[model samples]
Target chain A: MIDYDALLNTASTMGLRMLESGAEAYRVEDSLQRLCRAYGADSCEIFAIPSLLIVSLCDPEGHSHTRVRRLYRRGTNLWQVDQLNSLCRAVCQGTPPFPEVDGSLARLAEAKGYSPLLQLAGFAFVAAFFTLLFKGTAADALCSLVAGAVIFFAKYPMERHRANSFFVNGACSFLAALTAIAGVRLGVGQNLDKIIIGAFMGLVPGVAITNFMRDVLEGDLFAGITKLTESLLTATALALGAGIALSLLGGAA
Target chain B: MMEIFTGLLLPCFYAVMACVAFCLVLNHHGKLMVVSSLGGGVGWAACLLCAFTGSDIVQYFAGAVAVAAYAEVMARLMKAPATGFLVVGILPFVPGGGIYYTMEYCLSGDTELFLTTGIHTFGVAGAVAVGILLVSSITRLLREGRAPKNRHLGGEK
Candidate 1:
């Protein structure tokens, strides 16, 4: 007979470990695979909802790194599985996560047609286009571009450690705003609203809100509450950064 | 009208992008992607609707409800843990304004205003929590009432 209690305990422990180690959604997913193996389960899927705390951790130099790996059993062979990575970079600094796993997984997932560099370049370019379009000042645009580049470069790290989605977006927005503010101080465009709008582009919590509603409708109250809390917090973080900047600027006025 | 749409478009797109990012993070492609994208779309639409109506309370409630509904449905359909999806999907709809106001009031040395805003922030959070609880209780009752009967359901089949 299978030891259900032991399995449950192990799973719970793994979850707690991942949470404590600052593992984001992808890390949690990977951890779930490992947990399933420990219990001799054939297959498993895991998802960690974007929480405010998780989002806040997306600051480029906050907290330590955590790695989670998942193993899948195929007949007599145990194979490695690739988990999602979240990359959060500040301006031109920082590195991405999961280079090896990302490459391997892309190869396996797309056998004959895997091109990680191309995909990454495409994402970077798209992000840059949006940044330049919305940002009213060169400084703001440059900051956004740099942040996007950093995101591309550090994509593997961000994904591997499971940085918070909200945090990554919020940080990018904050940096953009900071750059715009600096531009204003340096006698650039005075379109505060445009800069504000541009900076806020990355701070929306659409996915979290949707998931919150879904969980509520599905009658999973605990999950719903947790998701709701997370959504609220990420929003708060964005607001906090903006509010602080505005307040300081106001004080000078 | 165009200005309003423009105002809404950037945020909506950003929200969608965030959702896609989350999907990538979770390695959810195929049907899961569709579900997540729909969830994101609904949430963004709610935000725009709230903005158009110019009602803060309405926006908050609408966003919360829409997101909660999206998450719950996906949770049931996917038969996976709902928390991950719920957390990620609702990222765009949080009440950032109230939080900013509260923090600003505090930093500006307006204790009364700060306290008031702080309380308001907590109230918003509480409201969201209550809504989640309400939905969850109803779901739990329905689940229990409709539980499948089986001999192998108990301790040792």
Candidate 2:
């Protein structure tokens, strides 16, 4: 007597998790279908978009179920994808009872992030090293570090309030630009161009752009175009934020 | 000779460190971070190779091919999403700097520099896409013949 509710829950939840963790739409569809099959379900079908996921499963006994989830927050956390990947392995070995699957997902959903301090440092190092890669001087890396810290730490409070993506990124890039320009104005870095470019790395649409590329190539044309436009706008917001500072600074000096 | 060696070595080193940091920021754990760093290093190494000898287009395409191929291999070995590796692995060639420089020129009203760099930037971006497409297409081809059905690259079945 396969518990259809449990099956539906697990299948849809896994799809949702994959979608939220920045997977391509086709991958999301494929994983959900496979997971359902592994669970003794006859079929699972998924229609995944950047903003919504719809899944339908038919159990071996010919029972059918459907779930539609409207996604509110889409983020990129590869860790979640890795966790789900392992969970699938466990299920295939012996279809875990629903509770075990449920427990693993709960833990995964609530997995603790690395400390704020460490992530802030990670941001700083990313900016600094990339500056060095771009042939910026040591002083430019130092300036990038400072600017990175400003942008990275500033994101916490902005996210706490659950602000809009464009506004949050726009505002943070604004801060990033101001900090880098100030560093240059104070003789902390030699090249404003290099420093600002390095500082902007943290805000670049890495996940979006990568996923969009994968999506387009994977034949998810609609999803690919959607993500492509979004990534482009995100890049635009970043440039806009930094542009304001540059424009103002240029006007001043 | 020494200058060329250092020129290549330093960028690769920074790329490795930067990829690790990028992974850490995205919350990748233990072995995944190391593997991703190696992948990024390979991609950056390819980029440097392109810079030294190849045309602008092929170099960009080659770097992307390196990234996509490495990410595909690593994902198969690790049972993780190739996207995880692809996202960070391709960072070395991402057009962040191009975007910034384009905007800078636009703002400064330097139409000449803006158009030239903008076209180049767009070309590099396309080259990266072609790289990912070529490798992913290969992976899909390899996965399609055997492997039962529809289970390739992170399906984990």
Candidate 3:
């Protein structure tokens, strides 16, 4: 006897995890439907947006079960998304037992990624090299490197508290701008524009913009629009923050 | 040779390094990280290679197309979703500085510069989107046409 409720729950959980880890809406919906079909559902209906997922399937006995999951936090952890994606494919292919599937999901949720130190190095590397790529002097890259570290340290704590993303982005850019300005004033960096741009690149909405286009092209207009608004708002927040810093310092370059 | 080295190879190197570091920030590891960062280099090179067009939008479009095609091929070979490669690979063309400058112009009351910069920024974004969409749609169509069968219709007991 197949447990319909558990099946719906498992499938919905998989979709929820994918969405929370920044999977595209259509991919989440497809994965949910596939998981259900793999578990003996005649057919399944799955609807997924950025923050919500709903999956419903009718058991062989004609009783329908539906599972709805609301995602509270969303971040780009491609590792998690990739792992969950592989897990979904494997389960669909082999029709794994329920316990094994549940165990894998639980383990993945607790999996650790890069260490904080390595991630900090990542932030610094991107900021420094991007400064160079944008024609900034070597000193400017060094300044942005420090500013990048500041943004990371400032943003990390807020992220842990689940603060509003807009506020976090704004604060990070504000801090980065101020740091860049100070670096220039102290003669440690040249070209304020280059340093500011490089420092804030870490906070830019590359993923959001990419997803906005992809979701739109994939016919998930609602999700696409949501991401477009998200990227736009993030850009606004960054500009507003940096503008405030520049105006306060009387250095509008 | 010096012009080619400075114009092409150096920038591509910077893009690839930045993308590799970015992969760390996104917590992507292993061979996928190395492969995806190469896509970034490919994108930047394509963008530079199209400089003769004298239009940023067309250059970005070409770069995005190259990245999307690279991502599709890598996704197939690696058995991973293309999103990983696509997202990381396209970063070099995302126009972060443009967004900053546009906002600065708007804030400083330079309405004319703001308008032009803002429009250009959106144009670059739209070009990239269209490029990715074209490649993805064509690939999907080709794959579906080739298969034309539902391989996982029912549960395997």
Number of the predicted model whose TM-score against the real structure is largest: 3
lDDT of 3 by residue, A188-251 (tens): 9988999988887788888898888777766787888989999999988998899889889976
lDDT of 2 at A130: 89
**Can you list the residue pairs that collide in candidate 2?**
none
- For residues B67-135, write the lDDT of model 1, one tens digit per residue: 667777786777544454455455444444455567567777899999987887667655554555455
Of the two candidates 1 and 2, the one with more favorable lDDT, higher being better, is 2
Off by over 4 Å in 3: B146-157
Descending-lDDT candidate ranking: 3, 2, 1
- Minimum summed lDDT over a 10-residue window in model 1 chain A is located at A73-82
- In candidate 1, clashing pairs total 51
- Fraction of native contacts in model 1? 0.15
TM-scores vs. true structure, each candidate: 0.50, 0.94, 0.96
lDDT of 1 by residue, A204-234 (tens): 4534454455445544445557656766766
- Evaluate residue A91 in candidate 3 and report its C-alpha lDDT on the 0 to 100 scale: 98
For candidate 1, give the lDDT.
0.47
Considering every candidate listed, which one attains the maximal DockQ? 2
Can you tell me the DockQ of model 3?
0.48
In candidate 1, how many Å is residue A185 off? 4.1
How displaced is residue B144 in candidate 3, in Å? 1.9
lDDT of each: 0.47, 0.82, 0.87
- Tell me the deviation in Å of residue B63 in model 2: 1.1
